[model samples]
Each structure stands twice: as structure tokens, then as C-alpha cells.
Target: MHRLFLCEKPSQAKDIAKVLGANRRGDGCWLGSDVTVTWCIGHLLETAPPDAYDPRYKRWVLADLPIVPEHWKMRVKAKTASQFKAVKRLLGEARELVIATDADREGEMIARELVEHCRYRGPIQRLWLSALDDTSIRKALAALKPGAETFSLYHSALGRSRADWLIGMNMSRLFTLLGRQSGYQGVLPVGRVQTPTLRLVVDRDRSIADFVPVAYWAIEVALLADGSSFNAQWRVPEDACDEQGRCLNPALAQQAAAAIGNAASARVVKLRTERMGEAPPLPFDLGTLQEVCSKKLGLGAQETLDIAQALYETHKLITYPRSDCGYLPLSQHGEAPAILQALGRGDPGLAELLPHLDAQRRSRAWNDGKVSAHHGIIPTAAALSLDRLVGKQRAVYALIRARYLAQFLPNHEYDRSQADFTCAGQALRAVGKVIVESGWRRALPEALTPGKGRETQPAQPLPALREGQDCAVAGVTLKDLWTQPPKPFTEGDLIKAMKNVAKLVDDPRLKQKLKDTTGIGTEATRAGIIQGLLDRGYLRKQGKALAATPAAFSLIDAVPRAIADPGTTAIWEQALDMVQSGEMSLEEFVGKQSAWMSKQVQRCVSLRISISAPASPAAAAPWKKKRKTAPRKASASKGSAAGKRAAKPTSRT
Candidate 1:
């Protein structure tokens, strides 16, 4: 009577196998006398194709669409049939089974689908593993949960999969057919998530294209105080300043600068110093890690995830890389000192931090309830040599490790000094920061750099100052400025927008729903969703920013407003959460989606579409080469109203 373990992938399978002492290799699994360990290469079975529902679906036509399967079927993935057979055999033999997949909704789907497909009726237990280190693995094994505990997660993931398939299959066919009627041959791929993401880019491009740059001016004053000189800016009074606080009248700015420059002395009106303390940043969640890597290391979103996966799966240096939470469980707090000691021993650069590592100080990151399925990504005790990682891998590891070390350090303390002065009856202000205690910043020297973009408050340390003290206004200059348009979406910026989608929404209920949900996609799938857009030509690289192509604009315009709204994902997620909580049934959710999809298809099928009409091109980078255009010709017959494309939808990237 053997107990069997089923894991999501081979790397994960091997990790669990080592803990179970199932070292001997069999057909497609590891075997020991008392137990067997096996894995599916991420779902050996997938939902059957539309053709499986009916043969007529093999051809793409409008009438044949709205293909809803009555009895959903899953077939073994052709490439990994052998592994499926091996797992099936193991399931048949075991008296009891353990599900050892990644501890998330998708992972639950991967394992549970197989169990139902294999017709297994054994007592099922769950091994929820967040980290692969020996200590974490053993701790999880000692307290295995019953399969019923996570069964709702499987339903949630299954609901998402089926919904995506319905939208992808039906909508792609319907739109592609519509485009063809207008003589456009390119396939118009639409997705529940990708469409909204596409809309985000499309909207941003429109905002940029329509932007009218407004010119303004400001006055700069250089002052000398107590043997130290610093520059400050003249503050425009209420009557002189524009809505954005820019001096709209250039002459007024010039007059102010001239008056201030002519003044020989100035008097300090007020001085205030406030002490501020900042805790270390929370550790890396997959989204935050992807954002930082995209900005600092110049890595793509998928590239960052790939590097992180390698660190987790191949090197066993860090915990699971796909976690969404940035908080760690309080239970893991005791393990910090050992990890810190090992880190110092691994790199001489970290040796200086060894003396300051205070394990007793608990930051806001250590909360038991805040953590879900998995905690934040962190270094595992198995990590020894940083030398094993190179390039992006090494860079990401360092970032993850740095956040862990910072939690033990004291709060970063600083003195913020603001000096207000009067020069020739003009108000001028200057602000400076003085480090009171380096604290966590000692581990991160780069944090001290001024003008790091996000922190627009320039750190100009000032010398000792006194209220009502006299100072000389050495010089004054007038500077011209223009209100800049929004920049294109960088992957980092996109990730942030995705996480904070709640801000974009207006409907209070939907906004609240989005707050409860992660952005448009899950952390595990966001990178893939982005890569898929690039692959399909819906989104193209205009240098570093992702811009929706003309094709993308047309597809988004062609779709119903309900489908393109970012809030759609929130509503869907709300229902899925209901399924997870048993407030809604999976069958009920899918049925509702089918009804909604059917309404959308019927409402849209009769509409005429003409893609030959031009679309406003996304704003171009300065370095982009100008494209050569063909002589203007008459558009397709029964085509768009004019050669000029419609004004794009309003955008904010």
C-alpha cells in the first residue's frame, strides 16, 4: 500500500521527492519502497478544443460561434502523454495521495483536474509548499492539510480557465470574421484581460496625441547662508500662478527674477525642521520584483519572472517566485538571523551589515493574516554561494536579499528642513534633508542619491540657518518650462498601474471590487499576457515603451464598451472570489458567463466593421525612424467614411 505525491512540474516534483526519500527513478516518477512521487508538466490535460464540441467549429464562421460546451472535456496534452500515463498509473496504485503543487489557485487546478480525470478515490492530503529549503519543506510536511481545504481554489481557477476559453474562442472568431467582411485579413485576437490591457495603451496614446503643450516660466534665486550656498525657487502668489502653480505670464516671471537679482540682501521669514522616520520597504512580491527589475536591471517582465523562477527552482536560493503578497508570516520570523548570517558569509559586501542585523526588531512586514497562499519572495537557507548566479539572476537575488536584511535594521531617520525667505518682497522657499540615522539605508547606498525620479523633492542639504537671519541673494534667473505629456507605458509603470487599477475606476462598487482583486491578471500569468500581446502584433515595441498598433486600436473600437472597460475584470474577479468562498457555485458562474457571452455575440454579429479606416498613430519616440508612406489611394469599397482615422479614445498611460 503506497502513498503517492503529485506535483505540478518536474522541478517541484523532485523537491518534494527528496523530502519523502523517494530517490529511485521509475518510468516518469521517483519511487521508494513506501512511497512514490510524480509530477505533471503543468497540466498534462487541457480543456478540449472547440472542434471537440462540434466538427463545424473547425471552420471559423460567425454563425458557428457562441460555441458553449455542455459537457466540458479535457484531453491529455499530446506532447506530455507519457508523463500523464505515468501519473495515471501511480494514481491507480496508491492507497492514499498527496497534492504537492505550488500553493495557489492555478496550481490547485493543475493537480485537482488530474485527480478527477484519473478517477482517483483515495484519501487526498495537501502539501502546501511556499519555499523549497529543507526546513520549510519539512515543516509543511509535518502538517499536511486535507484536500477538501483547497478544493474551492480549484473551482476558482477552473472558472477563470473556462471563461477565458469562451471569450478567446468565440470573440476571436466573431471579430476575425467581421474584419474579413471589410477586406482586412489579419486575425483580431481578443481576450477578457488582454482587451482591457490593450485599451489602457490605446487610451494613453490618444492622450499623448491630443495633448497641447502649455508654456510657462519660473524664477530661480541663489542664496548664501552661513558660509553655505544653495539655490531656491521663487513662489508665485495666488493671482500670478496658473492652476498647476506655473507662472503663466512670462513677463511677470522675468520682472520677479530681475527684482530679486537686483536685491543685495534677503531676510529669513520662517524656518522649520521636522524629524521623519521611514521603515524599510516591504520585501518583493512578484509584481514589485518585476517592476524594480524592469527599471533598475533593464529586464522585461517575463525576463524578470524567468530569472526569479531559475533562482527558486534551479538554484533553490529563494522561496517560490510567484507569490503575490509582500508580507511574510510571523511564524517565519525566527528563521531570519540564520539567513542573515549566511548572507554575510556569502558576500563580503554584506559583511558590514552583520554587526547591525537586529533580529528582534519586527517590521510591519511580519503579519500572519496579511500573508496568503504564500508569503513574500525571500532567500532560503539553502543559499550558499552568490557566485552560482550571473547577470540578471545575480542582480535579482541581491535585491531580494537586500529587502530581507533591511527588516532587521533600525528605521531610516532624517531631518527635513524648510527655509522660507523674502527677497525684494518676493517669497522664496528651499528645502533640505539631513540624515539623522542611516539605519536600513546602510545596506543600500543608492537610496541616498538625489532626484531618483519618483522622489521629486530634491534633497539639497542646507547649512545651519536662523529665523530672521540676513542673507545675500547672489543671483536670480528666469526659466521657461512646458507642461509635458504623459510618458508611454514602461513595463514597470504598467505593473504599477495594474496593481493600482482601483484608482482608474469611478464606480464605487466596482472600485471597491478592484481593491479586493489584484489588477487585470494574476502574478503567475501577467508576464505571459504581456508576451502574448507582443507575439500577436496587437502591441509593438516602439523602443522601450509598448504601444498599441493600428490593428489593436481597431479591435478595441470594434468591441462593445462593456468588454473594453478595465472594470470588467473586477466584476469577473468578484464572482470568482464568490466561488472561492462558496457564495457562488462554479456551474452558476460559467452559466452566467455563457449567457453574457451569448448576448455579446448576438448583439455584435450583425454589425459592419471597416478596419481600412486609418487610426491615430501612437506618439512616437524622438529616435523612431519616419516611415515612408504610399501615395494616398481610395480606401476599400464600402469602407470607412474618410481616409483620416477617427480621433483615438482618450488615453492615460
Candidate 2:
């Protein structure tokens, strides 16, 4: 039987073809002696527009507010129609087919949707590949999975796509028509994921704008012991502070400062030192990687994902770049030494650390149970020079390599000393840390302190002293400061916020569900969703931070509170996860979403609502100036990271 393979993209197809000896190039495909491999650019078929159902949908009208399709249809893009035809032709000729796409929900949809569209009736198998390396491909080929095992993934992805269409199409049209009546001619695009995300930024801006600064005071004392001085601060009693640990009573601070200033000498009431060990951090999940890159490298979310994808597909330097898990499988441990050796050969400077590289060390990162779908992104044994990589690619690769190197090193050990002093009838405390062993911290030069803020205080070793020892009080100072407002969302902060949205919620059940699920969006689509917001002018970039536009604020206020609440995202994801596990049928999930969309439209059709931009401090939210006074409208139906979809690279075809 002629077995045919379908891939997600041309580069991925080329990689698999090289291993299968598929040298001859056919139209939009590669042909070997017995096997053929064809690819979809990203998605070959998308959900049909409203016009496909009825001719009058081409014109925007209020009566066509809730456009729910009775029978969903898939439409081929005019740009990629030829390639779709080629894949359809290949499907017609094959006796059986193999789905060799990205090992994720969107990847499954890209191949399965085409199969359904072409009406293919043949036996099918799955090539679930996490990494495109030759060894990984060959191993997967030897153990092909029955297609039924992964059929649920297609249902889950299809559910997300259909739900997006229902919300995006119906809510967008409803709101745009409403806005036009108010004399604003802008299309307001909304999604299950985007509305809540916009609300996050808008809410933050409101808090910043309304915040009033509070004054606080702190007293710092310099203590002399054995001719060496260490810094300590006066401890505020519980009676003098508020619930947030802020010293609300400035008189208490003044009294403590006066007491210290009058003291001739201080007695050390207690001194204790204890040893502590810190384990190495796990490798980067895509969210963490995007976060760190946005903070350190000054790259946008899309830019970081694009660079990582290039490293995985174009250079073959790293394993799959779209992994959500920050852990490795136990089976992958054996390949570490070879990868490290390759790294050493590629960069001669790494020779110093090669002797310490241990593949046998089982850190917290290597666990079979923790890994799902794909393991963490790490370097491959491709043996390529570092000079070939671009600046940002090299920076990201170096970070991934550093995390791997840390596993082999010893635990970062330190000695922490806490000292208590009583001076002029006031209590004071100070801490000093000494490094016992550099350990894994030496692997990354940036990791030198036991805690992140510990470096601000110098790590001088404490002098040998017993309890009740006397020491001179060198100095005392009282500093006054104002409470700062919350900073606006940076791209990194936004990604981290999106990934950990459970913290924002107050409900116990939804919080637990969000924890089980990966926040608002999957690793593959978070970038695309954020990019879409910026491209659609709902969110604008101001230096290094993000601010919502006036239209965004207006939409958030005009829509029903259910659509803008972060808790709604968790509920939707719970439904999607259930569908993926076969606990709920795809039709049931889509039916529920469509019903929700239709209800929202009907409720808001004749409702009168005011649209006002959320006010914010100019320094924090720069987009507040872009706020336009939109006219009041009589009635209109209103509208996560977005659902899992591939973040197309710069070169998709």
C-alpha cells in the first residue's frame, strides 16, 4: 500500500522527507520510492464566512446580528488554493495516510480539516513528532500511532475554531454596526480570549489613575562589630503597621530613630547562622522564554517566537520550540552527553565546563509523568557553529544551554546569618549571607546571589560574636518615601500575567481549573493573539509597555460583564478540555458557545449604553490621549490568550 504523509508546513515536510529519502519534488509535495509527503502552509482551509451561508451577509446590517451557521463549511483561501488542490490530488491516490504535523491541537486541525474537506476514505496513522531531529523522526516512524488515538485533538481544535468564529463574526459585526450609529466608523474585533485580555490592561490603568500616594518612613542603623560595620533596620512592631505590612504610624518610626540616635552602644541579643541549599531552576517553558526575552532582549512576543521557530526548523539547533512543559522525559536523559559534547566542539570556550557535564544527574526537570505531548526545548546534537546564528537567536540558544548545564552542577549552598540587636530600648534585625559553594549558580554568571534582591545588600561575612556582646552604634537615618503606583504591563509582564491568570480570580473551583489548564492561551498562540491586538489598534505600544486604545476601553464597557471577566476564560477552557478528553462531545461545546453568543447579541440589541475611555495617569498609560469621545448609541449587541493556533513564521511557505 502507498502510505502518504501530511505535514503542517513545507520546512517540516522537507525535514521528514530527507529522512524518508523523499528526494523527488512533486507539486507542493515530496515523493520517495513508496511514500509521499505533502504539507499545509499553516491551515489550508478556514471556516466559511457568513456570506457563504446567505448572499445578503455580504452587506452589514443590524438584523443579521447573530450569524450562526446551521451547517459549518470549510473554505479554501484563494492564495493557497493550488497547494490545497495538490494535497487533495495526493490524498486521492494514496491507499492509506499518515498525519505528520506539529504535535499540538492546531497542528492536528491543519491536517484533519483538510482530510474531512477532501472526503478521504482510507486507513490513517499518526506521526506524533515533538522534535524534527533525524533520530526523533526515525523513532516516531518505527512506532506509528493509530489515528483514532489522536482524533480527539481534532475535535478540541475544531471546537476552538468554531467558537472563535461565532464570537468574532457575530460580536464584531454587532458592535461595529452599533459604533457606526454613534458616529464612529471602526470595526471592533472581539474574541473569547481578546476581550478579557483587554479588560486586564484597562482595569490596571483605572487603578493607576485613581491611586493616591501614601507616605511612609523607615529607620536604618549602622552597627559596628570587630571594626567592621553591617547595615540593619529598625523592626516596626505589629501595633504600628497596617494589614499590608506598611508602617502607617510615622510617629513610631520617629521614636525608633530618636532612640537609636541617642544610644552609645548596642548589645547583640542573638546571632544565628544556618546552612541552606537552593536547587537549580527547571528549563524554560515557552511562556517563561517569551517573558525573559521580552524583558532582557527587548524583543516583542511575536519576534521571540519567530526566532525560536527558526532555530528549531531552519537551523535544527533546538528541539521543538512550542512546548508548554518546562521538563524533560527520563528517556531523553541519555542524549545529554552527546549534545553537551557537540556544544563544546561548536564553541571552544565551553571546554572549561565540559568536564562537569553529567548526563546521569537526575534533577527535578527529568520526570516522565510531568512531560506531556512534548518535552522542554533544548539543544540538539546538530554540531553547528554558533557563529552562524543571528544575534537574538544566539542569545536565546545560550539561555537554553545554560539551563541544561546547571543540572549537572552541585546544589547552590550558602550560610545565612540573622542577627538581632537591642539598642536604646528598640529592636533591630539584620541578615548576612555567605556562599559556601558556587554550585549550579556558576553555570550562569548572572546567578550569584541566594535571592533575587539579596545583591542589593553586600554579602560580607559576619564577625565572630556571642549573645549579649556589646557594639557601638555608628549612625541612624530616617528616610521618607511615597508609595508608588502599579507599573503598566510590559510584554513580558503581560505574558506572565496571561500564563498565571488564576491568581487574578477569586473563585476556588475556577482557579484550580485554570491551574490545570495553561492560563488563557496555549504556548503556540499567545504571541499571535497579542500581535493581533496591536495590529488591530486595540492595544498600542508605548516605549516598553502596553496601553489599551479608546475603542478597546469602549468595547470592554459596552459588552456584558460576563464576556470581559477573566473567570469566563477558565470556564470556556474547562469545556474545551472536556471535549479533548471525550467527556463532552464537540457539537455540545459548540452548541453551548453559539447559544451564549446569540443570547449576548439579543440582550444588547436595543440596550442604551455609554462609552467612555478608562481614565489613567499619563505616565503609566500613554494611550489615554488616543481616547476619542464616541457618540452615545441607542442599542447594540456587544462582545485569553486566544485559542491555540499556530504563530506563523516570517517565511510560512
What's model 1's lDDT at 525?
A: 86
TM-score of decoy 1: 0.92
Output the worst ten-in-a-row residue range by lDDT, candidate 2.
Answer: 639-648
Candidate 2 has an lDDT of 0.80
- The local distance difference test score of each candidate is 0.81, 0.80
lDDT over C-alpha atoms for residue 127 of model 2: 94
lDDT tens string, model 1, 216-235? 88777888987789878888
lDDT of 1 at 315: 83
What TM-score does candidate 2 reach? 0.91
